[model samples]
Target: MNEKERAPIEDTHFGAVTVRQDGQDRIAVDGEAIPRVTLERDPAAETDPHIAIGTRDPAHLTMRVDGVEVGLLPAKGRFSRHSYRVDVEYDGAAYRFVPDSIPSSRLTRDGRHLGDFSSDGDETVLAEWREDGEIRPADAAIGYTLASAFGTGAQPMWMMIVDGVSNAIP
Candidate 1:
């Protein structure tokens, strides 16, 4: 496994919502698969012609774009893959990797809106964390990965290396 590699997208879950990669995003709305489009997917599909959207998760759904990924409907319980293309410059040297999609905002422990992670896209690299914003520092720590590009062995993806320090929830 490369140092930059992340966990397979299927194993990870968003917020309290859970969904599987490669499978359609069908959530049990009264025990029925309610079909819906993810917001992140909607924008990417409109902006980039290469985006391919999956089913909506009753919790949250993830969108795949030109190998990039982003979480849609995170509040519904999902993680974004790479909604935005970000360039990260780390340690006086620039290392640009795919940005893993995470919940941008969520209710805090005290019930307040707040950022999910802290990132400069130039300093700290991305990593995965629980919905509560706790870092496990485990090797198998859940993260994200990109689907292999056509004819390219490179599996482009990003993982949470340093959890973002978000703004205080009010």
Candidate 2:
């Protein structure tokens, strides 16, 4: 959708953090309405949509914090279209995001617990972080955008088959 036509899809608070996702698939945090991450739909994307964090390239899916860009390179699970797990590495840290259920996923960094990304089966989605200080709000926001926007969890085999058949017919 165009920028003017974009509407808010989610606006909710989890503890002190506020997360909002707009109709354009841009997600913002806290009181500032500026999008920190955006899910950019690209027809050329190999499997899933591309992500833009800050002013970085959407194709590379880099994360920018305080004007410094951190490269988020996919480490595993990139080939299988049905795979639910995605592993990435950046700044010497290994991050893993795997589905806990259809509407939620768990994020970990270097084998340490980080937080969760969940939806209420509606427009509202949340990213709640652990209290261990290992994860920041920006990190949680990135994780949430990745899991929610990328369709990170596996779809049922029957549903996949149905989708494939339907797409082929059309």
Candidate 3:
């Protein structure tokens, strides 16, 4: 019998929630050292799970996967310029903890990345991050307030476009 060779896809697990490769739209569930892939919103079987980060006077934030709202900040106005973290576990792996605000930016109609996050343990490996490009005025609808703080000259607001195709880790 011949063996089949399969490529490794990036995945992470934090407690109970698991984020598939590249933090794409879908996540997996781990059970007894086994992994079960979940179906995320599709853009041609190509899903892009996203995280968004921003600051507000009241500190209201929400996280969604592929347009499907997954988590919400019930306690609005709880934080002020502070970073919130949530680590999810899936597929027997632990993905870094991230805020809903981070992915929201990617899921937006015109979302972009602001920066990347280093792995919790490895410091050298890039766990996850946002795009490093400038988001257009149209894309800055909700991020405008935060963007203003970064300046509008050349950098404006640090952003990134998640390339799910890469299948990298958080």
Candidate 4:
């Protein structure tokens, strides 16, 4: 498959949280750098080598942003479809992750939202994004929310190369 591409916007980022994929998901935005929750397929730190994220075993991963623990999606999602949800408690508000459900997915809060991501086929470029009801440029929510299922034309939407790392319901 060809890599996803988008027309670069000159300085689209303005006091916004942007995420971009820079060779191995550097997780950066607007020339600034931010840490992200990491997902290791076969983490050496894991005690059991047999435990792996696949069809049966759930993915045991930690989601961190800017070197801070933001959430945990440890083997609770459907591994069969590479779908997982990382529950998070940030700033006294609860947040949930939608691991690529078809063309897009989202990171939501109580009544509002955190991030909304959308894409057509290319998992690399998130076409639309919204955070907290604010319309953020596609890459504004950058840095990256790497998932087990990025997208690959798989049957299940989660299995597709990528659901969406940004936010958008419309």
Q: Which candidate gets the maximum TM-score versus the true structure? A: 2
RMSD of each: 17.1, 6.7, 17.0, 10.4
Over 1-170, each residue of candidate 1 has an lDDT whose tens digit, in order, gives 11342332222322222112221221110001212112222222222122212322213333332223333231111233332322222123221223223422111222222123322211122333354443221111111211110000111233322222233333
| Candidate 2 residue lDDT tens string, 1-170 | 33343234343333433334443334444324322544433333343223222212346454443344554544344323335565655456777777665456778888887877765322245666677755554555557556544434444566668878999995
Candidate 3 local lDDT, 1-170, one digit each (tens): 11332233232322222222222322222222223323233433421122212222122332332333333221122232123333222223222222334322111221234333332111012223235554222122112212211111111122322343345655
CA lDDT scores, all candidates in order: 0.23, 0.50, 0.26, 0.38
Comparing 2 with 4 on lDDT, the higher-scoring candidate is 2
Give per-candidate clash totals.
19, 0, 38, 23
Candidate 4's C-alpha runs over 4 A off are 1-42, 45-59, 79-84, 99-101, 119-123, 131-143, 146-170
Worst 10 residues of 2 by lDDT: 48-57
Candidate 1 residues lying further than 4 Å off, grouped into runs, are 1-39, 42-49, 53-142, 145-170
Error of 2 at 168 (Å): 17
**Please, what are the lDDT tens digits per residue for candidate 4 over residues 88-167?**
55446555545445445555665455454543212243433352365332223321343222322113654332444233
Q: Which ranking of candidates, highest TM-score first?
A: 2, 4, 3, 1
